[model samples]
Target: MAPAITLAAEAPKLSSANTGFMLICSALVLLMTPGLAFFYGGMVRVKSTLNMLMMSFISMGIVTILWVLYGFSLAFGEHNSLIGWNSDWFGLSHIGLTELWPGYSIPVFVFMVFQMMFAIITPALISGALADRVKFSAWSLFIALWVTIVYVPVAHWVWGADGWAFKLGVIDFAGGTAVHINAGAAALGVILVIGKRVGFKKDPMRPHSLPWVMLGAGLLWFGWFGFNAGSWLGNDDGVGALMFVNTQVATAAAMLAWLAYEKIRHGAFTTLGAASGAVAGLVAITPSGGAVSPLGAIAVGAIAGVACAAAVGLKFRFGYDDSLDVVGVHMVGGIIGSLLIGFFATGKGQSAATGVFYGDHTFTQLWKQCAGVGAVLAYSLVVSAVLAFLLDKTIGMRVSEDEEISGIDQAEHAETAYDFSGAGGGVVGSVSASALATAAQTKKVDA
Candidate 1:
């Protein structure tokens, strides 16, 4: 019989290399939240840019506090099959600094903070779907509650040692199901409750700034190296290196495929399309990178890129306003990544299960993947819808119509993303121009 897993009882010697690597990786993952902010913010119209950015930024602050309090405990600590808890880790008390997590080289605190970054970003991903319409206060409250109720349990299920999916032999290398799918489903549910954005298909709601989008995408790509590779928890493992290489390959392939699709479908290949494709690739490869070969990564990326590009249009046909294609890119991409594992997983490396494509035709792993995806999708959607409904009835979920059209930036935050007043020049230059025009008019009248 396999030896039973046990906690690290002895004071294990700290590996400086592993600790430093994780610390760096943790910083990289944290950077993705702001990267997400810029990505979502740029996709929004100028009127709603600040609000979009704030939604992502707020998660950083809110989830960090929650994670420290009990989020970490509920996710990683010992508990029942569904969830986990340890009062000792509350506020990170009693846990010794020198102690390592079970079967890991890194310290418990490092892992806590690393996972904490994941918690912060998942709810933020949902905000993109409800952009331009959601009330800031309502969003803040939702983040706090959703992370506790929805995110915590789901994190446990996928990542926790005793969680059902983890125990059931599901292989989510990172967060294809938990983070992306969960956020995507939640976004869909909340939007269904809140209804469509005011303009829907009628308005020309093009992204205000593609440069910002490119920059954000760039940051996300850079940070994802850590997000995917760092999940290995130690740099010494060869798997981490493979994951890192696969991440880049899949993302690149996905971007190219998306561009090709855009060229074929539309007359021109747009920059925005390329950026979105890259993100789709990133999302698709995230869960599969650890298990799949480089060739598999390419396949995953290319498929995700094309699929998500197609899926984004569903909002228009279906009459739901997923403002920034969160459902398309995150939800659909996540599912693609998760399910593809059933076909592409080699069973030769880090993940020991053989996919059907590799001659394991029982489809056992496929069913497990489906279960993880279905469970997360169903739970997140139901809970998010309920939360949105309750908040709508009580505190009002959306801004007033006037607030939305006139500019959510000013109405919600009393500020705008850009200051156009001095754009013609400085304030003095505008004043001087006005004075010159007045003088010319006066002289004309005298003549």
Candidate 2:
């Protein structure tokens, strides 16, 4: 190991090349949040499109402030089992920090910001399950609080050096249990507490725009590069290059598997099917990709894609109203990734773990993986239930019936997405000045 240095050691000595790459990596993670916004926004009803977008954008603001405030301290600060001791902001004012990853010279702050993107998006993804009903202000407050209380602690446990799980030798290269499973279970908990939206099952509510859905899918796919690759914490070295390749292959394989399954079962290739499958691949690879072999990644991704696609239908059977399939995709994909690693991981140069393929201590590793999954589900559900109850009783959750029916865009924001029909009926080009004046007045009045 390189020489250990004190906190007083001059600012971390990173190469210019490493710093440039890290900056790009940080941008990559930031991109995922907006990518998430598009992904969820397309899944909601037309009436609540803007509100759905707001739900995600709000996370960028709320989580950023919270992460800086106390969330970072609770997560990464040095201290005990339950929480961190609020060490200096990972050397905030130092201009750089010693690289934490193996053989990297990048600053610690670079890694922190990349992870921050994930912290923001995980909760934002849950908003899909609770879409179109919860009060906007209440949501803003809930996610902020949830991240600090639930997310930070768990992140500390899995990722922080002093985290219990990390100390226990549980390997989560990325956040399988911490991010995906935690968010998915928490989504279910909050949705149950908030209850179903009006006519959730009775009404055949369809997505307002499929084009928007496809666009969001593209963005998510693009941003995921930073997500899986940036986990390397530096340049395209052995680990980073390997993760980058695995991510691409697994996603392609899962996409193919999903389509093949659908064609055999449903007789048609749906765009939504392809999008869902791609995300499932991404999630399944998040934790295990760097550890597992290429063949292993393909196996995990394809299985997760097919399994998640099937799981999405369960809401209709079980009647939970997980409006946007958060449970099906994130929860199921996370379980697949976390467990598959036990069967697929192998001892490499510095990585001493081995899986069932190696036929050594397979059961023990698998058991450990299962336990991690169980812990996240139990903790997130219980904590989320309490939080949701508080919000429901205090500020209330669902909107008024009048507001609900009119749609959040107009009901809450006083705006409609499209306004082509005027007294100059179906007029594409021109409208009377008086009508234009009236429309402007109506918009101002509503605002």
Candidate 3:
């Protein structure tokens, strides 16, 4: 009897510990979208507050559906250099429950859901740049199209197994390039096409709620631990632990650096500056945390905090109205983090890649990092501009001047974030009482 052909190797076993860990990580990443909503919502004028929150919240709905439908296939299935596809990934219908994700101990489903959270937030990041004036329906449509055309393809390029960047040895530990840079570039593109907010530099556009910004930043800081560490796929190695440590170290350093810069440059360490600095630090450490030492992480964060603080002022000089400094913070921070990897990568960490400062004598890794960053920035900027231009010409991307002045929440959502009708017991309350009396008189006359 032809000795039954023995299986070549034992099937990969599932680790319940890793599975449970990934599930929690997925939840944490999902929390970031709502965190982002509060962050951006508080930064816009009160008139557009609810619209701002909806812009981020709607991404959770739109991207989740797309990820399940065909997004996972395009981003992570069988691949070409630019994109991926597999018939089985449609609607995630064909994935088996116990199938492990390649070398990881967790199930493929866990990996897919974890990635879905990332996809949801990338476009949401762009919403901050287009705040106050975009039509909600148009913005929703943009999320659908942008995720398909920009985000999915970029995710494949940076993270897919056969992606050109991945094969070319770009080390994006999390998503400095794929998520932040892509979203930031797209934000720049769309804003250029849509024109500026009505007031732009002329208006006194300031954050309405510092507390909301702080709360959102706090949530983002907490959730980012999962975002940075979980990219390692498992805690079997010490890399995830290192990433966790680096995340905290980098964020603290960045926050302090930003406050120092603010005190020196503007003579005040503002709460807005602290919140913005912490976010800048989070962005900078995202891609490099796994490869850098704790000390290196502090350097990355400090640099990003100062650089992003400076960059936020450029929107005025350059004539772009980036309502929330999305380009300044996310784009600049992503670039700083991704490039610093070429400088600070230790051969001892996640991979064997060493940077210029860590024994590598050549600029090869730095060049590769540049290529990845440049390609993503250029593609996202151009394509997103085209998408916005087309939408503006066809269905219209902006609200009317009348609607914009009246407030996007009332124009688009028919809801208000806060109620002032009873606040002072003044004109609004008198108007309400008069309206109620008029209604009662009309009812009596009809009877």
Candidate 4:
């Protein structure tokens, strides 16, 4: 007003081709939810299939709503290192905001919706590690709290306009450390606190369906093109094309490595193993892909596959039942990718700050990466714990023993997924029946 109320000039417009590309990328990412459903559904008992599917589907709804409200602004808005306190709920009412942010072709609001999908899937991915137990109310609350407390800050720290890591030149082209490693550690924390499911090591808790897992893997793989490629903000850039190539290269390598490992260790490459391997590869290359060469991505994928395989067996050693090995795949994969960038990433003049394999400032890059890992892990763990504590104290976490004995689908949702032959119901079927059977035998022996 003092300056005559002159408005800033309108933002420049992106070409139509670029806008089309971004929209396609957005749609591709939207596919990840169903892919996630298949991934988790295959690992869980048949009795809890619907419950597992719901965990992923629910995220598509809850996170989208939350993202529109404040998650996006908090995550991507123009605030400081820790968090963004700009734009109240849905404050970004305009479209095609190129003047404010030059690189993106799409409106900030559209970009927010697109990234919202990422925020949704990352938390849902962790749910795999907690399958078959945990109340829906509690699960919903856990996710809501975890995303707000752990995910938003970590996301801002890594990708926000004022993120310190971005300023310090930590190249996370996608989200190796932020989404994969962050979720993996948080998964471990929650599983530790909640304890194991009823029949963890002793029971033959094999996946009820392998086809579902493969399907999920397939879906996740397809969607990753968007997850990695979309990071470019628009398709016009060469970096975006490179990211697309890396996504494919890493996923394929991970698949081959995982199958070979399974063939050696378990005597056959199971469908579940293949699906898991693909995901592991995707996680590993997320942070380093666009910055590195094809060879680098392959190396990253191969090592991530092997390392995640080894880590998955740690459940027997460390005694923390990471029910679906979220800790193994995502955490280890993220670490591998984060560390690999030190040895792999190079520019036109690789001589100046070259990786060790190229013989330069390799060790320095690795050290910075480790620091970032430590910060993200510590922050996620502590914040997740605090949030879990608050929710538990305030509204109560964990279902009752009775609910525990029954499948969450029936206990929490008041419905069962498959009533194949009128055998499944609220209390007289599936998990409930199993619990009752166990109780009756115990009573008989005692009597």
Give each model's whole-structure lDDT: 0.90, 0.79, 0.92, 0.78
Model 4 has an lDDT value of 0.78
Q: Measured by TM-score, how close is model 2 to the native structure?
A: 0.89
Predicted structure with the largest TM-score when compared to the true one = 1
Candidate of highest lDDT: 3
Best-to-worst order by TM-score is 1, 3, 2, 4
Q: How does model 3 score by TM-score? A: 0.93
**Per the 3 Å backbone cut-off, how many clashing residue pairs does candidate 2 have?**
0
Q: Residue-wise lDDT of candidate 1 within 1-447, one digit each (tens)?
A: 001255558434578898899899999999999999999899999999999999999999999999999999999887887989999999998889977777676788888988998999999999999988889999999999999999999989998888989899888887999899999999999999999878878899989999999999999999999899998888665988999999999999999999999899987789999899999999998889988999999999999999999999999898889999999999999999999999999986576897889877999999999999999999999999999999999999999998888988999899988885656457768788999999999999999
Q: Please give the RMSD to the true structure for each candidate, in Å.
A: 3.5, 6.9, 7.2, 7.7
Better of 1 and 2 by TM-score: 1
Model 4 lDDT per residue over 333-420, tens place:
8988888877887752211344557654438776767778888888877776676666667776666666655776787777776675
Q: lDDT of model 4 at residue 99?
A: 31
Among residues 3 or more apart in sequence or in different chains, the pairs in candidate 2 whose N, CA or C atoms overlap within 3 Å are none
Q: What is the per-residue lDDT of model 3 for residues 340-415, given as tens digits with 9 covering 90 to 100?
A: 9999998778888989998878888889999999999999999999999999999999999999988999999998
> What lDDT does model 3 reach?
0.92
Pairs of residues at least 3 apart in sequence or in different chains that clash in candidate 3: none
Model 2 residue 76 CA deviation in Å: 1.1
**Model 3 misplacement above 4 A:** 1-11, 422-447
